[model samples]
Target: MSNFWKRAISGFLFVIILTGCIFLHPICFFVLFFIINIVGLYEFSKMARRMEIYINLPIYLFCGSLLFTAGFLDAYIGYRDGYLWCFLATFVMSIWELYRKKVNSFQNLAFSYYGLLYLSLPFTLLIYLPYMTSDEWRPEIVFFPFLLVWFNDTFAYLFGSRFGKHKLFPRISPKKSWEGAIGGGICTIGAALFIAPYLEGLTVYNNIIIACIVVFFGIYGDLLESMFKRNIEIKDSGSIMPGHGGVLDRFDAVLFVIPAIFVYLEFVY
Candidate 1:
């Protein structure tokens, strides 16, 4: 089969799984995210190796497991301590790596930490959002962000390829255009406005602001991942997804945007 067909099939299955999680229960969603994080982290560590950079993978895996556990606790128990522990554990691991004279490369360790921030943390935020409250709006809270990001990406790719002229950041991502970025933002924000009222108890204006924040941060997240790819001198982070490239390529925007959204919801609500 063609690459397009393969992508289409995979995308369909993923969307089905995500939608099922939304409709079924938050546990289902958490399970799916946990698996994704494990696979995604493996891909990231492998990518690091590909760049001739090596860190203790076993330690990294341990840290990732802690993150996953802490994130779940934060989601369900309102545990502020989870994040605190995450930081402390990561620091201890870093220190241990420093003590290991066999691998004295700070650069590799730093890059690995960057991956945690860029990939694992944001994903945790997404997983945590739905469990923030016990309201009916919980599902919408979880679902809308992903929907907006997906819509933003689809429209940006479609419009940018058709009429892209001005480059957004030529050095990091040559294919990206400012025009498409703005266009995608407009589309996502507009959809948010339209969908905001349907959300259980959120006001239209509040949802509008949230939507704007999501779009803006989402764009920055995409740029950040693009910068990483450029630094590694690779076209894509990995080839897990046929057309989408890698988990990083697919999820870069969510990595940045989810955390911002989490903060916004915390402060605003």
Candidate 2:
């Protein structure tokens, strides 16, 4: 199959599965992201390993799972204290490094924690977002940010391909252009305006602001992941998604945008 067809088919299936899981029920939402969290952590560990930074994958996964569960329970059952366990886990990692006689023990320990913060924390925040918008769970709150990111990415690709004049960041992501980024921001803002009424508690103005946030940070997220790939001398994070690369490749923008959106909502609402 052509790369275009492969991309289209995989992207379609991904959207369908993700949308279904997100909107079906809160448990499904948690389960889906919990799995993503683990996969993303594994992918990061592989990347670090390629650079000779051997991370303890099992310990990272266990700690990350604890953090994810803490965030999940906090969101669903109103138990905020579970986050304390993440701190305990961090201390345990430090102690474990003391016993290991590896030369890069500190590097391993640091990246393990970094993986947790980079991949796990954002997902934890995502699980908590739906609960913040309403007294009960509201998937639309979770869904809208994704919609903005999708529109931004789609329009950016289209516009950049058509009228791209200047590079956005040639060093990291050569294909991205300033024209495309602006076009994406405008298109995302339009989507926000159109969907504002459906999202309770967010006025059109607020939705526009949120879309702007998503666009700005989403681009950075893409660039950040690109930098990682460039440093590692690899294309795509992994091949799990066929044309889309890996979990990190698929969720690079999401990892950045979700946290920004969560912070925005926390301050505003």
The TM-scores, one per candidate, come to 0.89, 0.97
Candidate 2 local lDDT, 170-212, one digit each (tens): 9999999999999989999989999988888778888988999
145-247 per-residue lDDT for model 1 (tens digits): 8888998998888879887999988887888998888888888889988897687656787678777877788888888878777777788887777867877
How many pairs in model 2 have backbone atoms within 3 A of each other, for residues 3 or more apart or on separate chains, i.e. clashes? 0
User: In model 2, what are the clashing residue pairs, if there are any?
Assistant: none
Of the candidates shown, which would achieve the greatest TM-score relative to the real structure? 2
Candidate 1 has which clashing residue pairs, if any? none
Q: How far off is residue 79 in model 2, in Å?
A: 2.2
Model 1 clash number: 0
lDDT of each: 0.78, 0.89
